[model samples]
Target: MRREFLFLSILVPGPDHPKISLDVFLQPLIYELQMLWEHGTEAYDVSCQQNFNMRAVLMWTISDFPAYGMLSGWTTHGRLSCPYCQDNTDAFQLRNGRKSCWFDCHRRFLPSDHPYRRSRTLFTKSKKVFDAPPPEIDGYTLLEQLRDFGANRTPDCGGNGHEHVYGAGEVHNRHKKSIFWDLPY
Candidate 1:
């Protein structure tokens, strides 16, 4: 892990957010990563005293919330802000601010016997939470769901020549199928 942190690649310039166009910048990196996964590079091993094939897999990414949306193709704003919850999100539009807010949405995840679950005044007034947490969707299932969605393909941005479709079917908050889905694994 420490050796992996020796180098960091910052793809974009600062002061402006890339939004959906981030996939364009990530194309080269994704191609290189695909090559590494398929056919590893040769590296000299100092301790082994021989050259060996070196391969790497991208386990995860580190980024702030806004950037997370860009990378994952999920919109962080609006009522469907949460990728995990998907269409089941309890977020509501604020009456005054006219913005989406997720207040008191986590009570469903608390234990049934927990006092917070029954405290009406503590959260939304007189509201009792009996709902269970959203089902956990695995990576393969997600990939299967997005396979035909034309991921990383935006017609305006030199994509795969497919028309960009937003909020298609159950993928409510998604702007585009994420570029990371291009990885075969």
Candidate 2:
């Protein structure tokens, strides 16, 4: 199952759509699965140390799944409390002002100096930047960039006529909306 997950993870970068089948996406997909597996495993270790019961484990598991927020009951996504506050919040207000933005760790706090403060992606070339409408580089907006890169349904490198290669956001969109920064879903 994990192998399949890893396989698929490569096909779609979390903030994007899935382009290739198990072929082209195998590398990145494996990277994503291993990453997710490592993170979840690490969180499980943390919860164990914290002595959270099964309920806690279940909550943590649900929190790790980015799609979890799209469910009817869970709307909030801001970092509400210490450590796990954001992780624990089932409901988030997406349209709320930035002050009300939610995160997955609102339940508790990992020390200010926690080591795993961030997780990174393999694509160092194209970093994600948001806050305003997608930028227009060379007369092309970000959406246009995506379309140009073939991030849409047609796949096979999209309209750019280049071999389609989608990032995480593109692939994930096909299944469900990820509750990440600047997701339009």
Task: Give the candidate number with the greatest TM-score.
Answer: 1
Q: How accurate locally is residue 123 in candidate 1, as Cα lDDT from 0 to 100?
A: 92
Q: Per-residue lDDT tens digits of candidate 1, residues 1-185? A: 36887665766888876667788788888899999999999988888899999997787888888999888877788888888888888888889989888999888888889999988899998998989999888988777666655455442446434355545534566667777887877
Compare the candidates by lDDT and give the number of the best one.
Answer: 1
lDDT of 2 by residue, 101-153 (tens): 44432222334343333322422223222212222234134345444444322
- Reference-based lDDT, residue 171, model 2: 23
Assess candidate 1 and give its TM-score to the true structure.
0.81
* Candidate 1 ranges beyond 4 A from true positions: 1-7, 147-171
lDDT of 1 at 147: 62
Instruction: State the RMSD for candidate 1.
Output: 3.3
